[model samples]
Target: MNKKVMSIAAMVAGFGPSAYSLADSQHDEAIERGQAHYLLFCANCHGVDADGNGPLVELLKVTPTNLTTLRSSGSEATVAERVLQAVDGRHAVGESAERKMPVFSDNLEISTVIEIAAYLDSIQK
Candidate 1:
């Protein structure tokens, strides 16, 4: 290929991943923020390490889930969907009256929930 044509191709390829990287970096930032949120609210039950070994686990009748392995077991999209649903109360309401998990819909903003989902996505085993 001519030098000019090769240069053009290089530019095009560079531009593509640049756009994707920008968005990917933004998503990474969201995940970091979500981890912070999880620590503040969920860490009590999910554990600071996110291994479902939170200090409060002994007090609860039901066992907490291991947050780290969520992605390894399922698609990232499905994990995020489930997390968002539970945070928003859609999953909570569907559960029986003896729900152990608190519905964050009333307390957490949508952005916060999204951040948490992103964080969970990054930490998956």
Candidate 2:
């Protein structure tokens, strides 16, 4: 192919939509819900900014995980898995040991938990 044709093809390839892009609208809506849920139920311990420095941190025997660093090493899928497990009470961590974090399975819908996981994953360091 000519250089110009090759360049055009490259541009088109880059612009092609993937499955994730097709779900962007849904993901955006989910993120909004997750943000609201986090603020209302998780902020007191996870912190409003998700930095694990909430006012109640000092009272707890175990420190909350610094959520901002949640994805420092793991893939997004791994992070999502961990978040789901934690919410479902299947994956307790240091903070969970103190029983400070409640099992959200009864409170949050599965979709909401997944949404929260997506939002948290989006903000990873």
Candidate 3:
């Protein structure tokens, strides 16, 4: 290869890790925001750790689902779909039948919902 071409390739290769690190940093920031939003809006029912044993769950007609298990629902598509429905208030996938989880469409922006979904996915084992 030409010397100039080889140098350009080396420079481009060196930039890869920095670009990936920046993207990772942004993902971390999104997760942090999602965690804050979950704490403020969902922790009361879902619990601070998302185990679904929050104090308020006892008073409710139904219990909330342990969100950490959402990945076991079979696939990422299913999880994403359920999250969208819950956020949209059309249905509650894993929660108890009588639960009255409020729709967040009006209270949160669409980007917030996406971030929450991403955060939830991150925590799923």
What lDDT is obtained when candidate 1 is compared to the true structure? 0.67
What's the TM-score of each model vs. the native?
Answer: 0.71, 0.72, 0.72
For 34-105, candidate 2 gives per-residue lDDT tens digits of 788878877788898899988889888777777778767553435566666666665545553544566887
Pitting candidate 1 against candidate 3, the one with the higher lDDT is 1
> Which prediction has the highest lDDT against the true structure?
1
Q: Candidate 3's error at 42, in angstroms?
A: 0.4
Error of 2 at 99 (Å): 6.1
**What lDDT would candidate 3 get against the real structure?**
0.66
lDDT for 98 in candidate 3 is: 47
Q: What are the clashing pairs of model 1?
A: none
Model 1's TM-score against the true structure: 0.71
> Residues 9-114, candidate 3, lDDT per residue (tens digit)?
3433332335456577776777788788878878898898888887799788768878888869664444445565676666535444543677787888766766
**What's the ranking of the predictions by lDDT, best on top?**
1, 3, 2
